[model samples]
Target chain A: MPKSINPAIRDFLDGRIWLRLHTPFTIEDINQQIEAGHIEIIQGIESKLVFMNRKSYTCNRCENTDQSKFTIFNCAKCEASCAYCRNCIKMGRVASCTELIVWKGEQPIYPTSHTLAWEGTLTPRQQQASDDLTRSQEINRSHLIYAVCGSGKTEILFPPIFHLLKQGKRVCIAAPRVDVILELEPRLRVAFPQTEIESLYGGAKPTMKASQLVLATTHQLYRFQHAFDAIFVDEADAFPYKADETLQKAVRKAVKPTKPIHFVTATPSDKLLVEAKSTGGISIINRRYHGHDLPTPAYISLWKYEHHIQKGRLPKKLTDWTNERIKKSEPFLIFFHHIGFMEKAEPLFQLIHPGIHSVHAAHPDRKTYVQALRDKAIPGLLTTTILERGITIQNVQVAVIGAEQRIFDKAALIQIGGRVGRSSAFPTGDFTLFHNGITYAMDEAKSEILKLNKGGGTNPDELPFM
Target chain B: MNCLLCEQPKQSSPSWQSLIAIEKSTLICEDCSNQFKRVDIIEVGDNIDSITSIFTYNEAMRNYLHQYKFLQDIALAGVFSNELKQALSKKKAIIVPIPMHPTKKIERTFAQVDELLKAADVSFEDLLIKTNQEVMGEKTREERLSMSRLFQIKPQVEIESTTYILVDDIYTTGTTMQHAALTLKEAGAKTVHAVTLIRAASEQ
Candidate 1:
């Protein structure tokens, strides 16, 4: 057999991500592609819960193998006991016999002509971090960007990204939260208008074009293998990413073995910081791109806030706090620990203004509601920790209703406080914690903000609008 | 022999009306009808005229339909069809089984919703066709709404003054049913109601 250069086969198989064989094509065509070395069979994982009789089945997609968790049924079609993994059944039902297919051919050779389109100048901190990142990218060495909140972390990413894209290498910016990816999508599109860029989350329509740049949630990385020349993980220490081992494995699997992976976040875990520092110099920037101090939360005692919500009334202090913002036509996010209490308090808060709405993890209008807040279409939103991070609203004041709840840990409180004063228009705003009593977590969050403010290394005396 | 699904002994016979409709051999004798949980609480909305489900889609129903639809077990459809048939005692309306897109039809040998209607001997016209082959089973409620352009009316359906009961296998979020109802009403349906074998719990 002779090797052939087939462009159609190359286009079909060259995507860095996994492509299931769902296209309208014949088996003979697939065989031809396979013979031409453009496609190969990738075996699915075997059952991790095989019994002694080898009659057990498990799902390899979500790594679910629990006997009780397995959805067992006797299939009359296959005439055998068939089991499906219900955990990831939404993607598609994966049975014991399901075959996972992947492309195994030469990838596309992109031209080194991609240009950065952003005209804004970077801050000194951003420039230094960008240079450090470029050096790391040059050697394909792992790096981290330990920048404070509102420290122009995304801008710091631009120069290094432009260099990598110009060199004709595929790169992905993966975040743990969907909101982060949503926020980055438009910014990245504007920054690299000429290059093909695809954004992949759970419901995002997968793009047909082979993108040189990709913005995706970490969960979407499971479908990729040796895809990116370099991968940047935003919100490196956020939940579901920090707790789930599979997500960490997914990021590792997404990038080629020889490629560099970088972490960028304001609240880096000690372990992450230590790891980054061990490998050469870790680029840490403590100052916001705007020369302003981090917002230190003001602790307010709203004794029995939950109790007041239960009585179908908002605490006078909380109500007054909300009314002030509403009267001034200011947009804000009031964080709650529980959805039930947040919903119960929503109508009472709505009494101040009908536009006030609440959202939780399962709210169907979460995206719309958040967008409205950004567009300032709504007065304010009652929310849970889902909006604690990756949400940027100009001049928005942050308030946590139940600051004493165990759910509002040190990291969560900081992230929620970080939501305030993020935009260039509003470099300083109030971050208030309304609680019956201040917990250690709240204290620690305040301390962390103050520490970052002191160590920001900027001319603190030159801070504006203080 | 015990019931194939519950494996419980023949506890109670099915109602006489349902018994007369099906052969004795196919009778799920473990009081399956006793297990027929009805969600009579109907919420009326703009696009969705009304929703009526015969069986409260519980755990067993999920497993049963999972096998019937995904596993392609032809036998389970008969069980569901029989269970739903005797209980469908409502206004006489033309049945319309939610359709699979042409691409999906080519992928799967048989249509899950169509097979149930066929097994039940229900008179249904293929008046609607799914335009997008995208699966809604795994999508979030927001995704389902955004992707609500999943269906289109078949060009040939002369729907001037006909009643339609949109037939589907399961009703969870009611997104698909609402889309179908909206499409039917837009095509000049006088009345559009939805019927599903089981009603899954509203996660909300």
Candidate 2:
């Protein structure tokens, strides 16, 4: 008789497909599991990843199909010139010869009962969206929560997530940026107090316990296969996911076959809006939960701002904005298009105030700097679009330096504007667009905010500040 | 054509060498080639008779070796083909690539030294077989020196009483080359000289 497979190994590998040998699992246990016919060994780089006729390769895990991204190296294991996917090489090199182990045994049952510890009531707008999402899950159709920022989008997701958990189904909330995942983990855990929730991101330790609710970055979903019964993509139109097709494929590949992928975003792409409309349906919530308008952005023309910053001088208008914020003792964030320009302008901004700092995606102290800003320890920060979303600071004034740059698209600008007026205690703040010249994106972003604000209730002049 | 190292389109001005060698186009561009810090022939003393290295292990060479050996960008083996050919062709000694352990060979796919020689279109003798699986790069200088004999002469292979030049991808602490040379000397080789692509600045 075959020996029983190890429960620990099974739980770890249950839905995590395409794991390399000895990765977070002992080789002996994996081999034993294989002997018991509870594990399946699949080729790391499936033949489907390669285009035979074109002499190109793709990464099966990340769905990276770019011809340039696939590289060939002499593989000792296969004894051939095997192709490996460079796109997801950081996770582990996936070559033709590498064996990916997956658990095909009896899946461990998750707890169907869960407790939502959150006592806060959802607004009527949020309730409507929540009901719409729960209805979409019943019919097994994809849905989009086209809600404005600070509109309790996460609260809307709670009902559907709870419904899925009651059915003993696994649910995933994936975001493109790690910030979003970090932001959701604590909230989701508090809300689903008794549920097994795990947050997966870069460098995160893998949990041995079988988690029913998975909050992961889109990049982390590359390791999963047919894992979640329902996957909700939070910040669906965010960076990397919006610009990269492979990330889109990763999200699709992560979900179980025929399962729906609901999207929750403040500003989704036109393609996503259309896809949702044609499929499950779109549920729009234009109002913030606080019942206030999105902070309308005011334009400030700073022509040759780069030249002035390069010359070790902040532009006059930018200096004025900084002075005003400093005079009011308000914490601020100045967004730049490029890191080089941001760094060049960082010292100039610091001249106005010594504690002002700069941050980018790869900045080593990004977490601390953001935390420092949140704690109001620093006066301000000059940053790239990395801080465009998922960060909430009370009474934080915002500015976009070089707003005319192509990087400041309508979606990005809208999200940046969303950064302000988030918390109800500080309902309104200044949002300045410091631009060299006006661009169509700027006009679209301003009009989009105006349209959303109008859709929320009434004219900003008509409504009193909360 | 794309440059073998950078994979960028080859953009190089025609020099007198390129003009004469019309059939042998440069595999890597001038920009990529300029990064290597070529050094003069330095004699590696002790058990080995002498050693010759083409380039010092500068940043570019380090990156090149990382991509070539670790990342398995095998096309990079041709980046210095012409230089290797020019250096090895003048030597009267028999070319013997420092052998990889059978398991390491499998892990690395093609033997790095063998591919370098193959890319240069130079023939070599497979006279030695590596016996141990320990990688020289991972061990400290002292640990590597004290490690057990890692190479053995292949069965039935004759080590003629002539000079044998051993080829390797990089020369670090020279422990690997010493072990390889000692094995060859014991197998009746007269003189053992080492040729490596890059010489790392020894760790002080």
Candidate 3:
């Protein structure tokens, strides 16, 4: 092994963390690096026998220890019954015989001379939260920014991120949903114009550049290992991340062991709130940056709205609401709990205004449809909870079709209502919850908004802002 | 029981046929099996006498192969094991699985053709060895047609004066089968027949 490392190998692997053995790089180059002690290989899956000689396999990358998600097959390569992790198989198959390579070469030197090109000024509340975040990073402490939706959460991250980058520290902002990452990429790129930013998601093109800042979905973090100095999880309580423990483990695995994971979200769960309070690292901003009250959802009863929609009829109250938004040429978003119901109601909504479209998680045109609404090229969209967060459409009226459904929990309903009145240009809009019957979740969501509007959750030190 | 392909529980309903015949555990559900379009098409090649395919290379079959082979989900090989068993049971010929290159076999972890035959509980012999590691899937039809000898009989294998059946996962241009059939025929086999899980629809 030579003391001098190959530059090509270093460039390909610098901050990539861990990559599968079968990568884009040539085998000869990788072999040379391995011989030079500039690269180390880790077994993709490790196995050990448990009780009664039942073998248990754990994915080295995702740390998935669940026995059900592991499957064994007679492997010709290893000549044994090798186990692979099904949980993270979509990234690539990580079997017991497979190898993952990480760079042990000299680290790339990052430029400390960088600029924060954000031209906008933060409000007093935002500045205080931003200072709190920056100070926490200076002391190497975890912090939570409990800001309301549309409270300029992304802007609050800029100063702290720039401060870290000034010290040649790598940072990653991971979100649970791809939508949040997609929304944050362009904004972060604009804020730090000189820095190399890599945005990684499921289908994103692989990049070999050594980036100082990374914006990726939490699912994408499974490929990264001890890569970031500071990792901030945006929308930390969102779906899959909140419910799936593996994603939380991925976030913890992605950052350096000595560093901390900061969480930024509008609606913090009681568990998150209590943890942050014990550490004295929580900052709450009750008001939106536009200085407008959060839109409290107004409930309207539409008994058997499903039957009318299935029977090719629109309920009267819903029709009137759509007609008003159509007449005023205001864009609207009607959330549905189920994709099937939203699809059935699509044509009826389109009949009222032919340009209305429906979108869901798997919709091919979901990205384009959201773009169309932002461009004002369409009337509105009927979507599932996928659009509950990480979207801002000015003057767009919002409604939820099945508010009583179990899918619309307190956090979900709050995020949905936060979609309204986002832009300062039109800081107030109608937020209606059309339901067959009002449930406890709906009432709780409405009252939570009222409480936040009355400055109930603001930081105690900043009570004067109320 | 769960479907081998989709991993969903099989919907079982007792019928008159269930009472009379021994119950065989359903390996695939109706929904997953229904997606595959079966085409019992047979094509006669110059060297290989005939190539019989059980299914067409439709979108569903493509995804099935991707999961079974590329993604290395070995349980999916049993998805069509029953059909393969029924088809191969009556044949009087010796079964030979198309061999993969040793390196490629090591990389893929399992021989897909051998696994397909093993899942059906049909015994097979590896009579031929792949000479080259070039993936036929990456090459065009013209390139494949022009490609040279890819298979050769194993050194110690004896080719008897009896019928031989060649089994492969897919029949693309009939090039690999033709090469293997030519190898076996040159080794003194009486006749060669091919069976593939899927026959790729001819490119226009």
Best candidate, DockQ: 3
lDDT of 1 by residue, A265-293 (tens): 87777677667667763687777788788
Top of the candidates by TM-score: 3
**TM-score for each candidate, following the candidate numbering:** 0.69, 0.83, 0.88
Q: Which window of 10 residues has the lowest lDDT sum in candidate 1 chain B?
A: B22-31
RMSD of 2: 5.5
Interface RMS for model 2 = 3.0
lDDT over C-alpha atoms for residue B42 of model 2: 68
Q: List DockQ for all candidates.
A: 0.05, 0.35, 0.60
Error of 2 at A177 (Å): 1.5
TM-scores (chain A) of the candidates: 0.88, 0.94, 0.96
Preferred candidate (lDDT higher): 2 or 3: 3
lDDT for each residue of candidate 3 in B1-204, tens digit (9 for 90 to 100): 666666567896787776886544557888788989888988899898899999988888988888878888776778888778776878999999999899998988999989998888899998888999998778887888888889888888899999999999888877788888988998899999999888896664
Candidate 2 C-alpha lDDT tens digits along A343-428: 99887878888999999997899999988988988988999999999888889999999999999998999999999988999889
> Tens-digit lDDT track for model 2 on B53-152?
8899888887787777876666678888888888788779999999888877886677888889988899999989988887677878678777888889
**In model 1, where do residues sit more than 4 Å from their true spots?**
A1-9, A15-28, A48-87, A374-377, A456-466, B1-196, B199-204
Best by lDDT: 3
Ranking by lDDT: 3, 2, 1
TM-scores for chain B, in order?
0.81, 0.93, 0.92
Q: What's the best-to-worst order under DockQ? A: 3, 2, 1
